[model samples]
Target: MRIFVWLFRAFIFFALFAFALNNSQEATVRWFFGHEWRAPMVIIVLLAFGCGAALGVLAMVPAWWKHRRVAQRGGDIAPAVSDAPTPTEVQTPSGVRDGL
Candidate 1:
C-alpha cells in the first residue's frame, strides 16, 4: 500500500512538472490600485497556492489553541463511562454472592 501511494504521488509530481515546463510563459497579475506583478505562470500559481494555504492555517489557529489549552488543564474531551459490575457484585465459585 505504501509503495502504491508513493508511486501515485510520483506520477502526480511528474505530471505537474510537465505542465509547469510547458507553461513557463510570463504572466501578469493585476492588483487593486492599478498595481501589476509579473512572473512565470508556474511561480504565480505556486505563490497563490502558498498564500491560500497560509490563510487556511491561520483560520484554524484559534481551534488548535483551544484544544491545547483544554489539554493543559487535564480535561477530557469525552469523559469515561464504566458499566461493568464492581468486584463486590461478583459471584463466588461456591455459588454464593461475594458481598452478601
Candidate 2:
C-alpha cells in the first residue's frame, strides 16, 4: 500500500513537472493596483495552487494540534452526558422522581 502511494505521488510529480516544462512561455499576469508581471504560465498556476494549499494547511494546523493535545491528555476531558434518565428513575406525567 505504501509503495503504491509513493508510486502514485511520483507519477503525479512527474506529470506536473512535464506540464511546467512544456508550458514555459512567458505571459503577463494582472495583480492588484493594476500591476502586470511577466512569468511563465505554469509557474503562475503552480504558485497560485501552492498558496491555496499552504493556506488550507495553515487553517487546519490549530484544529489538528488541539486534537493531538486532547489525545495526549489521556481522556481527561469531560465525558458526554446522556439525555435519557437512568433506568432506576421513575417517570411521571409531571416529571421524574426517585425509584422506590
Q: How close is candidate 1 to the true structure, as a TM-score?
A: 0.72
Q: Candidates' lDDT values, in order? A: 0.93, 0.88
TM-scores of all models? 0.72, 0.61
Q: Which tens-of-lDDT digit does each residue in 32-99 have in candidate 2?
A: 99999999999889888999999999999998888789989876555788778786684666665659
| Clash count, one per candidate | 0, 0
Clashing pairs in 1: none
Candidate 1 structure quality by residue, lDDT tens digits, 1-71:
99999999999999999989998999999999999999999999999899999999999999999889989
Error of 2 at 63 (Å): 0.5
